[model samples]
Target: MLAQNVKKLIDDKAMDLNSQGDLADYVSKKITILNDYIEGKRELSEPNVDDILSEIVGFFTTSLDIPLEEGTKFLRARTYKVNHLEVNVPKLSYIPLDLSELATLGRLNKEKEPVYYGCIYFEEKGGVNVAFSESNAEVSDNVNILRSTAKCDVNVNYVGIYDYVHRQCKPRFMPQSMFEYFEAVSKYQEEKFSESVFLAHLLCDAFLSDILRRKKSGNLYRVTSILFSIYTESSDIDGIMYTSVKSEGDPVVALKTESVNSKLVHKSCDNYRIINDYGYAKYHAIHTHYGSISGNSVSWLKKNT
Candidate 1:
């Protein structure tokens, strides 16, 4: 189905000479990569389908001067029921990338982009509901489907919550926390270890605060304890801490346990701690250098979470 969708995307678009040539080149390279993988001559990692599609879309929209809406007509439309409301929202389907598949590709000599796709459905009926994608890649048209419809008074109170989560639920950690984390990483990459360590400690503190807010734990000591427990108990602390707890039952427990057991979570926490304690001043160091988190760590977080 996905392959067909991709092919449809390719066929539907009218292309100029340059665009056609680029498309042919891209497809030919991709096919060669796949063939090599099949014959065991080389290992091919799955490319991110959405990203590749988005790049193709970009070629049409930017290079060919095609309207954005016209360029994204090939994406599969999916209908989702808004919780507590009788509205059915239509959206483009997103596929999930699997880490195990990426790990398999990582073992190969050459770099391969993992191309797994899956959609996350909202099972619960209420609260601030927000759908997000990992990539900010311009894969889909930004034209609003709801613009033509009359605005209904569904739940005004939930609007603020939705907005908050929308901005916070970034690719990795919340945007601000992710920024700080990356800044620490950048410092480390620059060989400014002390500054990197300080920023890392700060990042950990920010992360803890976010967790406490989500958990609704206001007491500082309790927050600290919960954060510590989360770091210690779960391998995927971010997943465990970030996953919405819609209902209290086996489902939540199962999800929490699975996230906690993830190796990525363990590594993230371990790195956080390592950076936190690496500096001479445990909590008060002020650093000028900025660092970005390593790509491997970022990939791990994205995959595991």
Candidate 2:
């Protein structure tokens, strides 16, 4: 019964891939080879099993244009106990990407970003279950079932046990804000100073807001002031030099209190005031705000944090 059900699952998957024309022949041949081994007509070596798995993973990555590393993570195998029988199931989660905005960005300059959708897949003892959720839903579930298979008492050796279910997912790495900030830097390198400055301002606002939230002080004014003070003081030659030199005072206290203007009033006013005060001049103007945070400041933050 298990063998028949597994064959049906493979046939369904092969039918889906076969619809893609050129991939049809390849899928048919591989499925036949796997079925031969499963039926005991031929022996399946570990390398042969790996090759089949690679071909399966390649189908997804090639079709979706996703990186191989990211695509392979979706294919998994595990053993589960059901009615005292151990069942091994493999699953695949496919995520579709909206390259429309990315294509538009390639053609013209724009601030709009691409969107991504979410998809989840779970393979039961004999069937597959799928679910859809928001784009922000966590999809990278790195559950390694193969590693835990040893704990199972039943040693089922059917090749069909490695069969997987594919259901159409959603997407990370660097922080989006930092990515935009680096993009602005690239723009600056291209001599698009105006666009760079605009992006820099956006990044600056985001950075300050992030700090405020992380601190959770409820006093945006004080938080912004402290960050601005840290930036400006770090920019000074003496301050930069003294950072490396051991100081008499507590480094944390000095970082918080030093060079911050306590008298500055108004939240919105202080926000831009800190930006401009840090030397982020207008178009074609030198003394960039990016220069305000010195290497010493970064080192200090890294050490303290």
**lDDT of each model, Cα atoms only?**
0.23, 0.23
Q: Candidate 2 lDDT, tens digit per residue, 195-215?
A: 333233233323322332232
lDDT of 2 at 126: 12
Estimate the TM-score for candidate 1.
0.18
Question: 3, model 2: CA deviation in Å?
Answer: 38
**Per-residue error (Å), model 1, residue 226:** 29
Give the TM-score (vs. native) of candidate 2: 0.17
User: Candidate 2 local accuracy as lDDT?
Assistant: 0.23
| Whole-model lDDT, model 1 | 0.23
